[model samples]
Target: MSYRRLHYHLVWATYRRRPTITRDVERSIHRTLRNKARELKVFVYAIGNVEDHIHLAISILSTIAVAECIRHLKGASSYIVNREHAGIDFAWQTGYGAFTSGDRDKPMVVTYVRNQKRHHGAGTTLSDLERTPDDENEEREE
Candidate 1:
């Protein structure tokens, strides 16, 4: 027998950072993520989103790589969302932010992921979590 716990805070955005995550599609999107996570034997602690991006706090089995989880989740969610909602051109941007969180810090990460909308609305978002690769490039170009 073996024991291991791996928690992660995952974040990603829509294709080209488009604001396509609307109220109506939010349900479908979350459902898709949950379903895919279950199929991958991953546990989703929390999920939150704004118009363009999403956050997921999850614990993945040692057997699965974080990138593989993201690839499947994003691909299935995109497929389901676009299939369910006709004319919605929803796609996830390539690349993601995967930050490891210790078991002791898992609760905080879950809370942060769960409150993404409020955090963004109240201007209390943690910059480190909100930033993406393109953001860095954009900053350098400034």
Candidate 2:
């Protein structure tokens, strides 16, 4: 048997960073994301969102690419949200940020995701959050 442990901190925003995910629809969106994750064989350890963006701590299967998983999750959730809530055209940003972590840091990542509301409430915006090495590299390249 093969052993694999892959954890990712996934971040994505709504189109134009609009605050489309309000309190009234947050639960439905989260539920849809969870359902989509299950279909993709991904394990969602934690998921939380503020107004315009969301954070997910997931353990993805070795067989699935991170981008592919995110595509499905975002696509399905947007479809459901738009369907249920009329007059609201929901869509995700073109790109996403993904950072990989190990078992040792899983607890910390989960806590971070779970406390998103408190963090944002305290004026700790998403951009103010810690940046991964990938983020730094992207910044330099840009």
Candidate 3:
């Protein structure tokens, strides 16, 4: 095979630390993301969200750029949310975190995404996993 397949495990959060994703809003976001991915020929292995963040395990299409894929997912989902909940004031952060996954890690990533709500209940955030030294320094200074 001359070409290789790629999949990304992505996580992103709401704008300004807002927890706008209630049960209904979270479901709407997931559904919108699924439909957008399908339209773009991307395969979604798993998708789930907590109150403030979302996780997605998606197979990246060779023909599509990652930035473009993220644009469609983020933009469309944000629009859908604002439309559904007119007064909810929903928006996503300007940046997202995407990690490349190997075949062996696919199952692990899928399980993580599927259990996002449960994980959130345990008070774990993706940022917690990537806490930087600068973050700690800032925290200590405060």
lDDT of each: 0.86, 0.80, 0.78
* 1 against 2, candidate with superior lDDT: 1
Ranking by lDDT: 1, 2, 3
lDDT at position 1, candidate 2:
71
lDDT string for model 2 (36-141, tens) is: 9998899999998888878999999988898888889988888888888888787877667898888998998888888888888997655634332332223111
TM-score of 1: 0.92
Worst 10 residues of 1 by lDDT: 133-142
Off by over 4 Å in 1: 135-142
**Number of the top candidate by TM-score?**
1
Give the runs in model 2 whose Cα sits over 4 Å from its true position: 125-142
Arrange candidates, best TM-score first: 1, 2, 3
**Residue 69, model 3: Cα distance from true site in angstroms:** 0.3
Candidate 2: Cα lDDT at 132: 29
Best by lDDT: 1
**Which portions of model 3 show Cα errors greater than 4 Å?**
123-142
